[model samples]
Target: MHIENADLNLLKALDVLLEERHVSRAAARFHLSQSAMSRTLTRLRETFGDELLVRTTRGYELTPRARAIRQELEFILPRLRAMVRGGDFDPATSTDAIRVNCTDYAISILGPGLLPHVFERAPNLSLTIEPLSPRTYDEIEHGRVDLALSPVQPPAGLRWQPLFEEDYVGVVAADHPLTADRLTLDEIREFPRVSVVVLPQEQMVIDRRLAELGVAQRSGLRVPYFEAAFTALPGTRLIALVPRRLVEARRADHSVRLVEAPTELAAPFPYGMVWHPRLNSDPAHVWVRSKVGEVAAGLRPGTP
Candidate 1:
């Protein structure tokens, strides 16, 4: 691990040879002669006490030890290159891929606008938005996702940054009677309710607030996604309680009206940007999180 004694150039040459699997091709890639690459491979084998590559019927094969070290090399090589080329990241030229995990509501409210801004700034940077699964903490811990946007707080040992808070609102068809009057829990409960199957914590919060005020309602339907609930409200008497940001983002095109829920039943839900502590000091991760914060700021209350 000591940089002073390590053969950094040999490591690079070995990485290319491992990937190319042919000495001639590896030499071609590094613009070196085949003999030079062969010697480099010999140094690598002696340095590591392993025949990193062996001649095989299929050109070359990596030893088990080499295969084990491949992942480490892949991770470290990039950082090495980045360290050599010191400069601010230009998204337009960077081809980095960022992966984010988020709920359907976040995708609906923020994703549509966020992607374009990112692309405009960093055309070569790609994004992969994964569905926010139930075991969010596990996914983040295991590196299955880079960032997660959720209303729930991140589990212990993870870093959770509060992005913004959203208030609950009732969404009904544009012509629903509740749109004509101030929405109260009594009036909202009078109609069939469309419920989204969310986390147990969310259910407890809703039930606790409603029970405190003695409000009761019958569930008309249950859906897994907020988009489904939003689409289903066009002609039915079903009213859905969803985040105000989600409703506001779609009010222009969707035939839905956003009504303030009863204060007694309304509660502020805090949405956060969460990531593993392992990536706390990573520059790329910091950039991505800052972009997420910028998006959250634009959507915060009174931003309009």
Candidate 2:
């Protein structure tokens, strides 16, 4: 398709109609009368050589061609808006939604504090916290999310920036016996342990670290999320090996005690921010990444 002779106004009209999926709503979005919007839709059909949107019982539905082009519009419309607005990224004024994928641990440790800072800086900005799915690398590569924060290394073709290094700590109830003494690898291995089973990539790194230290323990329970692991610790005699930052965050609310693990078992678990190269130049994404890095820096060893 030769975009050189295309009507740019029609592109904007199509974008609004596709999003609203109704003539009246699309007219309201563009501040046009319903008749004007209908005319715009007709022009769009002629330009695209397709009905694009077909009426449905519930609402308007996109044809397969329209569905295929929806993502392209999502990507292109933002850039077009930026260009028309003189490419200014005024955080205080610009309203943008950023999608981020991360584990429950990252959200517990970093999300609470980071969100407020982001809102303060960019009040109009919205956030979508997506689950860190098994196919996270593919999600990042295909632009399903703006950024990903995880302990795993990024796959090829993606860029990774190290945010912070977390270390494993032994967590138990405040009155647990080992809270008074430094936790030894042998002692940790002897007791029932609550382990948070992450994705395969993270599991590989943790397993490698445990093997290096010869640390083997009987798993009392395996949970999918960190909050579950933390919740399981208050009543049981089970000890949980979790990130120190997470333990510190929950210390005030829960009567949990954090004991440093033996140096050999206290491997540095580095969490990083990964994004596709295509988004490397996106201003909003860069701003969000920088803010996340800043929050991570402040959460250093004992500050969380």
lDDT at residue 28 of model 1 (Cα atoms): 98
Candidate 2 whole-model C-alpha lDDT, 0 to 1: 0.78
How many residue pairs collide in each prediction? 0, 0
TM-score of each: 0.68, 0.80
Which candidate leads the pack in TM-score?
A: 2
Summarize candidate 1's per-residue lDDT along 1-304 as a digit string, tens digits: 4457668778878878888889999999989999998888887887888998998888799999998777467556545644664545666676555668787888777776677787888787757787777776787786656789887787789899998877777788887766553477777668988877655335534555676787775868877788888888988888888877777777575588777777765558678888988777566666778887888888758211
As a TM-score, model 2 comes out at 0.80
What is the C-alpha local distance difference test score of candidate 1? Answer: 0.75
- Candidate RMSDs in Å, in order, are 6.3, 3.4
Candidate 2 wrong stretches, greater than 4 Å: 11-13, 49-51, 83-87, 173-192, 200-204, 211-220
